[model samples]
Target: MRVMAFDYGTKRIGVAVTDPLQIIATGLDTVHPNQIIDFLKRYMQTEQIERFVVGEPKQMDNTPSQSAIHVKGFVNLLKKTFPDVPIEMLDERFTSKMASATIAQSGMGKKARQSKALVDNISAVILLQGWMSKP
Candidate 1:
């Protein structure tokens, strides 16, 4: 079964999808906050996505942060829209920084790194990879 992962942010929602075997995750794209539900609905209709894994933002100390609340709200919306698909939240602490580092190491120009949507989508890929690696 394939799984879709989301990195929910105030401005953008990053999307990533796993292979049909659920072994690999690839960055898809970042969509505007208001378009997430519609994007997911269209994507689900095209692909056989069976699960959604949303990144749960928290502070370094593991306490809930303001971003966590936003993520929770997004998840709730997901539940209401796709009640049958299971949704899980995975801790997303350093995924953004990690994604930036990955892009830096890839030799991308500074202008590319400045694109928040690109970083967000890459972070979503990292979040999904981490979840896929879990036992």
Candidate 2:
């Protein structure tokens, strides 16, 4: 079954999807926060996604932050919208920084790193890949 991953943020939501065998995760796109629901609806209609994995933002001390509240609200919406699908949360402490580092290692120019959307989407892919690597 395919799995979808989300890197939720205030302004943009990053998306990623796993292969049918659940072996690889690929960066999809970054969607406007306001358009995420609609985007998910359309994506689900096209792809058979069995589950959703969302990044749960936490403070440096591992405490829940104000942003967690918004993420919880979004999770609630997802639960209500797709009651049949299972949703899971993964700790997202340094996904963004990791994404940037990955891009930098790839030899992408400074201008590419400036694109927050690209970094966000790549972060989502990393988040999903991390989860899939677990037992």
lDDT of 1 by residue, 16-63 (tens): 999999888999999999998888888877788889999988898899
Give the number of the best model, judged by lDDT. 2
Off by over 4 Å in 1: none
Task: Give me the displacement of residue 114 in model 1, in angstroms.
Answer: 1.1
Cα lDDT, model 2, residue 5: 94
Superposed by TM-score, candidate 1 places the C-alpha of residue 106 at a distance from the truth, in angstroms, of: 0.3
Q: Residues 17-104, candidate 2: write the lDDT tens digits.
A: 9998998899989999899989989988878988999999989999987799989999999999899999999998899999989998
RMSD of 2: 0.9
Name the runs in model 2 displaced over 4 angstroms.
none
Screening candidate 1 with a backbone cut-off below 3 angstroms (N, C-alpha, C), the clashing residue pairs are none
